[model samples]
Every structure is written in C-alpha cells, then in structure tokens.
Target: MRELLVLLLLLPGPAVAEEAPPAERRTELLYLLRQDCGSCHGMTLAGGLGPALLPEALSDRTVEGLAEVIRAGIPGTPMPPWGFEITGEEARWLARKLKEGIPP
Candidate 1:
C-alpha cells in the first residue's frame, strides 16, 4: 500500500482549497470521511482495501498532493475520484486532517 502511495506521488496533478467546513458541515464531512473514505481506508485508517491513512504512513505526502488525489484520484487504481461529492477545498481539508492522524 505504501508502494502505491509512492507511485501515486510520482504522478502529476492540480491542487487548491478554501476554509474548513463549519460545525454542522464539519460533522457531516467527518461522517463522510469515516463512512465513505473509511470503507476502503479502514475505520481506524490503519489500512484495508486502500492504503493506510495514518499520519505516520502519510508523513512523506503533502496535504496538497493528497487533496489532489482525493479530488481527482489515482489513475488505474480502485480509488475513484470524489470530485462529485467533495469540493477541492473539502478534499484539501480532509488531506490535512488525515496527515495529522485525524481527531480522536
């Protein structure tokens, strides 16, 4: 899985974002992350069908890059892009939070 991330990082992509979601929206977004992203990334984010999203695992990855991946997804992989459901800004926020190992 780590190897996949390394390969993904080698690919080129776009990036950007705005302010994080508000309290209510934040809760919804967090639920989306847990239920949607968590489906593949694992509820604990340790690893599963998708790569581990834990902070230590994602240490080498930048927030922008991960955000791009979420927005556009890695080509030729099971990881589908979430552009339809999540905005670039939300994706960026998600990436940043994932980097910090997610809130408890």
Candidate 2:
C-alpha cells in the first residue's frame, strides 16, 4: 500500500504536462549549455570548476531537483539563477537532457 502510494505520487497526472521549450530557442539554449554552463561544468561536462553533468554523474539526481537548482541556483556557489533567462519548462527540459547526455 505504501509503495503503491509512492508510485502514484511519482506518476504524471493526465492534466499536468511538461512540454519542451520552443524549437526556436533550442539553438540558444544549447549555446548556453556549452558556453555559460560549460564554463564551470566543463566544455565536455567532465567536471571542472563545477561537478560533472554527465549522465553517469547525474544518475542519482532527480529531474525536479535539477530543475529547482536551475531555477533557484545554488547558494554560496558560482551557480546563479537563470530563471529570468529560462522558463521553468525549459529548465526541466535541460535537466532531462543532462541526464540523457546532451548531443553535439
């Protein structure tokens, strides 16, 4: 019963959907991912000033948690909130991609 409740909570509701950001912005976002984010995360996302963003490194992180970090930024760290530049939906999208490995 407890496990069923947890599973249900994790399931996406029919009325709640998280769509990807506009296609037009993908180019820009990808650039940010490489240049801005890469500045710390590493050009190859192999960990430099910041921790790695590779799928293997992010295997334990939750999409929602990553989205929160993207939106709110980490305190006492170099990471800053990009919420103004990127929407919540877009942040979520990025989190998913980071977990799956961003394509070149």
Candidate 3:
C-alpha cells in the first residue's frame, strides 16, 4: 500500500512539471513583439518602418492572418522572413498571444 501511494505521488510530479511554462509563452511573445519585431515595426509596436501592430491597428487582421504573415513574411519591405527562424506553430502561438493581448 505504501509503495503504491509513493508511485501515485511520483507519477503526478512529472505530469505537473510537463505542463507548458506560461513564462515561456510570454517571453517568446514579447521577444517577437519587441526585439525581433522592433527592427521594423518600432520598439513599442506603435509603428515605424513597418506598419503598426497594436490592437487598434491590427483589428482588421485575425490571429491566423498574423501567423501566415509571420510564416510567409511580407514582400517588398524591410521585414524579412521569419518562417525559417521560427516554426509555423510557434508563429501561430505568438500571433494568438499578441492578438489575445499582453501587458506592456
């Protein structure tokens, strides 16, 4: 009985730890929104060499559209392709996080 109890407790530890880290999601989103994007979109994402991506400006675009842009890259502009650097899934995650909203 004690061995079974110990096994049950041990099983949950790995299961709980396997959960994705919220910090990772936030960090990746911030990096994409700020650093990686700042090169053209401006430091605050308000607007710069690239078009603004703030909620107000991006209201017309859906998360999927944003993912496609990230995956395919905008043509005829300074924004280079990121599909090679980050996977489509990662891009989708970033798009969802950004569109869903995040703290400044």
lDDT values, one for every candidate: 0.76, 0.78, 0.64
Candidate 3 wrongly placed segments (more than 4 Å): 1-26
For candidate 2, the lDDT comes to: 0.78
State the lDDT of candidate 3 residue by residue for 1-104, as single tens digits.
33433343344332244322354553555565677787687776777988877777777788778989988887987777788866766776666555644434
- In model 3, how large is the Cα lDDT of residue 33? 63
lDDT, residue 89, model 3: 64
lDDT, candidate 2, 1-21, per-residue tens: 334334533545432455766
Evaluated against the true structure, the overall lDDT of model 1 is 0.76
Cα displacement (Å) at residue 91, model 1: 0.7
Which residue pairs collide, candidate 3?
none
Ranking by lDDT: 2, 1, 3
Model 2: residue 14 alpha-carbon error in angstroms: 18
lDDT per residue for candidate 1 within 45-81, as digits (tens), equals 8889999999999999998899999989889998999
| Cα lDDT, model 3, residue 13 | 35
Give per-model TM-scores. 0.77, 0.79, 0.68
Worst 10 residues of 3 by lDDT: 12-21
RMSD of candidates 1 onward, in order: 11.0, 11.0, 11.4
Show where candidate 1 strays beyond 4 Å. 1-18
